[model samples]
Target: MSKRNQKNRQKQKVNYIGGRKSFVRILEEMNEQDPNLIRFYKEVHWSRKKGCFITDTAEHNYKLMLERLDETEVNTENNNEKCNAAFKEVLGHRSGYAKELGHSVIPEPSIALHKNRDYLRIVEENERNKN
Candidate 1:
């Protein structure tokens, strides 16, 4: 074989170690500081053996994790909408009262709404129990 052909073959060769490192590096990069992505990466049972992630079990589990993450995001968005509507309703009622009394009522300090982490934990526990 010519030197050029040998060089081409070497260039085409797969570096398994480098490829493995890149696979993990790419996943980390795609995480983009999202809590869900971070949790998914941390929780998943990544195998050290070559080709383990391509197995049927690993693929199915990964798909399920992705679906769960999507569902959680949708649920969070829905909850946020509900919270905003409720807050608006409360503010409207307060404003109407102030207007009826013909006085400038001092507005109360706004309390920031936050999701209860324990609620999520309970829901997850219940789901696991159901399964």
Candidate 2:
């Protein structure tokens, strides 16, 4: 609050996107010493220790990531299969949608969904959010 202290305070203007604000120290170090610190500025930072990705500390983290990735692929494939089954069932209904439900269909239907793509997309998104 003193005039001398006020004079010592510097004014700064800043803008940031996606919550990735620059640190004051890093800013000062942009033309800085320590090449390793410069390397830090260039890399994308993950709050979770990234050696966990490659190091497998307890081995659990690595396993968990692999599990999630595997589950994602499985779910995608399962959804495609379910959609195809739905398309097949719709064809069986003789509801005049057989052509729309077949291999001829550009976009296939899922096991429990209607023809409109948005509805299926919404269902999938909701499921993902819940998980």
Candidate 3:
């Protein structure tokens, strides 16, 4: 190919990559700010006039993006559950230790409420008091 043609191809490649990256980044920000908007985007069909023109490739990318978003949400929930369980286990050990030492044990917070940062801080403060 001529040098001019090669340059054109390189420019097109860069534009394609940049466009795809920006699309994903924008979607992530939108998801973080308002997940309902992402859901609406996924559900609404776009037309050339009403919404932005969407090609077959763009449609496929949208599907993939939604799938990734859903997977990420599920993974996050699982991680949070695991973290809460670990916290509960630690609290259990602390309570047992206090019982052994004849120190009055602080009442454990409900499992559902353990996700609160304030609750975690209170537990940490109680531990420090014991030490």
lDDT of 1: 0.45
The TM-scores, one per candidate, come to 0.23, 0.15, 0.24
Give the alpha carbon lDDT tens digit for every residue of 1-131 in model 1. 69998898777422233344443454455446542332333233344664455345445545555554445445664654443343333323344343323122444423332256766678689999999
**Of 1 and 2, which scores higher on TM-score?**
1
**Best by the lDDT measure:** 3
The C-alpha lDDT values of all candidates are 0.45, 0.40, 0.48
Candidate 2's error at 62, in angstroms?
40
Q: How many collisions between residues are there in candidate 3?
A: 0
**Which model, 1 or 2, shows the larger lDDT?**
1
lDDT of 2 by residue, 49-76 (tens): 4432222232433344344434444565
Q: Every model's Cα RMSD, please?
A: 25.3, 22.9, 19.2
In model 3, what lDDT does residue 40 have?
31
Listed per model in order, the count of residue pairs whose N, CA or C atoms clash below 3 Å is 0, 2, 0
Off by over 4 Å in 1: 1-18, 22-24, 32-53, 70-131
